[model samples]
Target: MAKGHRSQIARLRNENKDTRPSAKVSYARVSVTKACFVLDAIRGKDVTTALGILAYNNRYASSVIYKLLKSAVANAENNNGLKADDLYVAECFANKGPTMKRIHPRAQGRAYRIEKRTSHITVVLDEKK
Candidate 1:
């Protein structure tokens, strides 16, 4: 096999063997910009702290993301046999989703275009070292 192929195989072999499971929420009603605000707050926070932050957040998107976080935590516990206290926000991000276009009635028989936004959110938990 080529050197590049050998390296790729080795990389995969060295990856974490833990069975930690993650959950994703796609096409959420929240916008990417709004979701990013919540993600930033919990990027490096511990599981407990992150939950606290989400609980107190007044933003609309926080509710949705908090539910996703809980789901991921449950996945890690039930699927991977990991403890909630040992998990952290390893990776969390929101990407822009498809825009739904609609027309609004306007004066002079003209229509105004409106774009409703959506977001794709993902949460990944890892076992703390």
Candidate 2:
């Protein structure tokens, strides 16, 4: 049991030691599925191309993701001393967040529950090999 704990600790430490610059947008007013559509398009894509795609994409989530991608690139350049041109999106994903419960009035004095979903999106940028 002690040996198992040691390995688990090592794994946790390694996971927390990522050097790539990343940015996260939490509690974004978008569903995970909608955010994933935009994130999928930019995963493994270069920063410039990803920016262009986000700029012209019609999805509502794209606008939120565009700001996030820019922030990640800025983090890489300013904090990590990396060139924006040399960076690519190494990882991008969206996770489900809390839902805002709302009530919609209906006929006969009834009310319908509405759930406005939210998501937490993250983008990690790394230098090209």
Please, what are the lDDT tens digits per residue for candidate 2 over residues 21-41?
Answer: 999999999999999999999
lDDT of 1 by residue, 13-49 (tens): 6784545567899889888998999999998787899
Q: Give candidate 1 misplaced runs (Cα > 4 Å).
A: 1-19
- Candidate lDDT scores, in order, read 0.89, 0.96
Q: Estimate TM-scores for all models.
A: 0.84, 0.89
Top TM-score model: 2
Specify the poorest-scoring 10-residue window by lDDT in model 2.
1-10
